[model samples]
Target: MATIFTIPGSLRSGSSNHNILKFLGTLVPDGINYTIYDSLATIPPFDPGLDNDTTPQPVAELHRLITNADAIIICTPEYAFGVPGQLKNALDWLVSSGTLVDKPVALITASSSGEYAHPSLLRTLGALSANVIEEACLLVPFIRARIQDGVLDDELKEQLESAFESLLKAL
Candidate 1:
């Protein structure tokens, strides 16, 4: 069975970014398993002192989750026109652990205006050597307004489902 690990880049409780993840869970059709990593809050800051030694338990667990997954879906929310520090920290941890290297990844962001962070994040992911599936990316502006009650608008639901299905095919 193919498995996909989805990371919601926003730490906001009940954030639309996370709501999209929940929607994705329901959309995971037969023949594919989608797992949501809901422990982002437990991951500690990246510290070199913990690098090779027994790292923070949560960090190790997160690494294992990504390392075992067939692909990754990252949904971020831009903060100050750039990536959130928490998400960047998580990626930094993955970089040192080599968990994301060569993994097929889809980078997405929820925005109120435009894809302000996508370009920077795309470049950063490229530098990390992740096999990012650019075609699978999406920049959803005014996501909260566009998605109603945890469901995407009629027009966007099909698009999101198709994007996910495409990522599944790649996996």
Candidate 2:
């Protein structure tokens, strides 16, 4: 069974990004072991000072989690018209560790139509040496309206299912 590492870019508990991740969790089919990084809020701001041998335990755990995962799925919401600070901070921690190098990753965005923020994320992920599967980018427009209680609307659900399949194949 493949291990799926889910990263919700939002730190807010009820954020749309988190909700999207929950929706994807339900889409994980049989034989797939999955886990979501629920400690984004606990991650401190990335700093060279703290990147040494004795960093906080939570930061070390986060690095270990990403390094051990088979594949990564990121569900993010745009903040200030760009990637959220928490998500960027998480990636910053990985920049010096090479944890995501050559890793198969899928970036999903939950935003209104015509409001996607993936190109920037894609560029950043590529710069970090991630093998981002282009076909696995899932954009759920009007996400709040389309997915309720972690259940996607019929059309979005189908798209998410297909995206999940594509991600698994990318691995």
Q: In terms of TM-score, which candidate is strongest? A: 1
Residue 72 C-alpha lDDT in model 1 = 94
Could you give candidate 1's per-residue lDDT for residues 1-171 as a string of tens digits? 778999988888778888888877888878878887888878889888887767889888988998889999998889898888888888877777788889999887886754768888888888778999877788888877887766678766776787787787788
Candidate 2 local Cα displacement, residue 100, angstroms: 0.2
Per-prediction backbone clash count: 0, 0
The deviation in Å at residue 166 for candidate 2 is 0.6
Q: On residues 1-171, what C-alpha lDDT tens digit does candidate 2 reach at each position? A: 778999998777678777667777887878988898899888888897888787778889988988888999998888777888888888888877788899999999887642646777888898899989888887666777886766668887778788888998977
**Mind sharing the TM-score for model 1?**
0.92
Alpha-carbon lDDT, every model: 0.83, 0.82
Model 2 clashing residue pairs (backbone)? none
Worst 10 residues of 1 by lDDT: 148-157
